[model samples]
Target: AEFEIPGYLVWGALIYAIFGTALTQWIGSPLVNLDFQQQRFEADFRFNLVRVRENSEQIALLQGESAERQRLSERFGRVVGNWYMIMRRTKRLTAFTSSYAQAAVIFPYILVAPAYFANKIQLGGMMQTASAFSSVQTALSFFVSTYRTLAEWRAVVARLDGFETAIKSAAAEAISTSSIGVLSSAGRDNIHLQKLLVNLPNGTPLVSADSFTILGNQRTLVIGPSGAGKSTLFRAIAGIWPFGSGSIAIPAKATLMMLPQRPYFPVGSLYAAIVYPAEVGAFSSDRVREILIAVGLPQLASRLDEEAHWNRMLSLGEQQRLGLARAFLHQPQYLFLDEATASLDEASEAALYKLLEKRLPRTTIVSIGHRSTLEAFHQRKVVLRREGDRFVLQNQAEGVKSSSDAPLA
Candidate 1:
């Protein structure tokens, strides 16, 4: 009877072990999927927060703080609510798994106890029977215990698949729908636009020009009303905005630079911030100091080694001056200023323009500004006027001819 009882216990253990492994895998898969999905949702929510922070200034100025806050709150609320759902599901799964495991330990003993009690096995035999039964049940219950993890894993796979799809869609759209072509113009004399059409982000026509050419080494000023597509035109020239149909032929060897009203400064040493598009050692330390002093930023000359967030460290006016100092150092063949000097006073702005005229006479200047003071620096003016649904550039006749009309030597 003792030997018979041991045989029965061994048989029970074998059966439990076989079933437990299969069940554990089945239950664990869903839990892993759920956890993975939760992580993806959390990442997306954080990305939105970064977007809000980057545009906080504009939002605050336009009194959009409440709206942005509400939007962010809605996004975060979804994240929290989804996480709670996932947690609850996990809790239920854990409860079931734990109970099943506990019951599994005792189930074999309960069944075999009848035989042992019936004088079928010794005490040692009975103890061994129970241990074997528990081992079998533990192995079989693996799936039930790991079900949550499996769910989380599946969720992660789904989120990653979705992100991939989104990236592909964005990339395809960028390639196929844009009409702006960036082509090479090896050593061309002028920048030409042929049958150019500029559009807004929504594909609405903003501007159309049949043919235009910006002569080399000639200063040209672009004037337009708000939202008249001046900046859009510039973006088209720079090959960033691809929503328009046109061909822009730039000089092959000409170096072009654009300085906006608010120039971006990297958060690092002042030296690194000054020669941004170039490496830190591109210019000598002394040359950078000289340019800074010339632009009325003598104080910053000593701070070249100091590391800080230059964007938030300097005011808008100071930043504009820094941008001009950069321009002086780079000395590009062509410079486009989109209200780059609007922040400074008229005197300072005039002085900086004069400095450019005096120092870099050969560099062509194309500026977009509302101030009349800017007209004195440029030889030609082009204004954008609204037609039916698009803007057209019209050249304005020059009233006062400057003395230095000769092409730069």
Candidate 2:
């Protein structure tokens, strides 16, 4: 035998690679699940911070600064607590990987040293044997070196899978529900609800009407007790609430707008907010200032060009005035109000309604309010009364009032 070099080096390198990869997988498996929780907890904490900033004014008004601070602290604590677990897991993983890497350097020499001492191989032959062993070990331990990256990738895949599943479920539900069909009509001058039944997302009936019609250019007021599905009815009419049965035929080429009690204004210039749902330059600056003054917000007229968070900067009563100002600017054929003036006093409420009557004489107005003073502005009144599990609409007797009895604007 020229050298009698042993083949144990080759077999030893393969065994070490297999053992190291398997151990690394076992130790790092928990990291995949922890990474997912850490991401969610961190995202939740960030979202809570944004929510606090958005509602900063309300929190200050309620003097709930300490409560909000405590809530934020609690949410942040979860983020920190989960991060600590990730760090510990990573620490353990690093310890094993580092040891495994160092051992591979000296391991080949240890296997070939015995053969060199027995005089079975020359120094050059022993060096070649060690180099070959090193190459095999490196190839086998590839997974061991990249274990952390694989864990993170697994977590990302899981989050994306959950998001995709949720979207598929919502789309499927929409396709399956064939009721609450919405049809648009061009020649008609009224809104028609035929065999309509509005229901909650859980299938509980809210409001039912066999046939209902809102004629063109009419002032109609809807009155009902608390939780009588008054707002839900408006949502259905707007073609947004889908948990219902029957068809809503809307006039074609007609514009409809809904004003809630607390109207939303985007964070931008007051001029932009005033003509929102309308493009910028839709109305002249002079026209916007004039409408602002007419709505009793003369102070804001000068600040039309000033950019601010108008919703947070303005009071509820002031916001309602701005809402009416918006209605005046847009002048849609139908304006639906859902307790849109609840924050204003009785006198101010009457003045706004009078302004609407004078400015939008042709626009059909529908209002939901509990106040008796609102009755004087509308020509017809309707009420929603509970009939079994759902509410049915009842048309009240038409009240007649001369122009002399109306409140002056």
Candidate 3:
């Protein structure tokens, strides 16, 4: 115990450092999973609260406050329950860390006490030894003290990494060489599809159109039975659905817009919502008001500056009008309307189409609808006729025709 007595401090610190680090790591491993779960629970609870707020009008009309409260309470209970679990685990970690720190402070003296009593070292020498031991022990316990912070930081980093990975994967698939291709045909007015095939994400073939042309400046209508992939065909032309092969040659420098059944309007002033995705001051206030009036939304003309959730505040018919207003504002060279007027009565729908023709005479319009009335608007009828195992938008005259007709141009 000659030289061994002097080295005892280092030996004791080394032993504790190994065991302490291992203990903290083992105790904190579960924190990552718990932290992630807590985040999900909290996010879900917040989402439900926002949903109720957005749909408050419908809830009030249905007198479903009690049902909403029950659903929200269940979500909140999960949030609190998961948070409690995190607290319990954190409590255990903090307790161990506190106990470890207190013991570490006294640990140096316990090691030096034997030499001080044996008279092998003076009081000053013992104190100095304890001080050096304390410094060394502090340096060695760095990881042990900060395990909680490390665990939480790792959780956030892991979640971000997961999101980034998912985004990259989706981007890669969308632009893959094997997927559908979008090409630009300069100086050409029409969009041409050569050997175009569209499929679902699961590789199920949906639409097959080879050597089909969407004639420029001509009003086109696409009609098919429900779930016949008519919408998917539109997506393919828009260059968003990439699960297929073949090239879609679009006119160069052409601005295209697609209005879905339920058009989206960002929560903001009527003027801003109507001309969304465009700068706020892109269109003059006077022109916007005029267009709103033309679309049969005279009431919204004066409320241009009024801020509200336009989608919820307006009925579906009114929303469709606003969607058309967006088209008129943008005046895109190509416009695809996917049942964009189905909510409106046949009379209003017909008026809207006529206004579209008058306002954007040069814009090529495509409409997707089930109504027989829609045929009166479009010049060329493209039916997604089922031939064998696939569908094509072949040309038709007057009423809906069979696949024996020529391909739609």
- Per-candidate clashes, comma-separated: 36, 1, 1
Best model number under lDDT: 2
Off by over 4 Å in 3: 1-5, 58-67, 387-390, 397-409
Rank by TM-score (best first): 3, 2, 1
Whole-model lDDT, model 2: 0.89
User: Candidate 3, residues 149-244: lDDT per residue as tens digits?
Assistant: 888888888888999999998899888977999998985579998898898898888899889999898888889989889888889889888898
Best model per TM-score:
3
lDDT of 1 by residue, 57-76 (tens): 77889999889889889888
lDDT of 2 by residue, 129-209 (tens): 878888888988899999999999999999999999998976665555555877897745789888999899899999988
Winner on TM-score between 1 and 3 is 3
For candidate 1, give the lDDT of residue 54. Answer: 73
Model 2 vs. true fold: TM? 0.86
CA lDDT of each candidate?
0.80, 0.89, 0.87
Q: Which portions of model 2 show Cα errors greater than 4 Å?
A: 1-18, 56-63, 107-142, 400-404
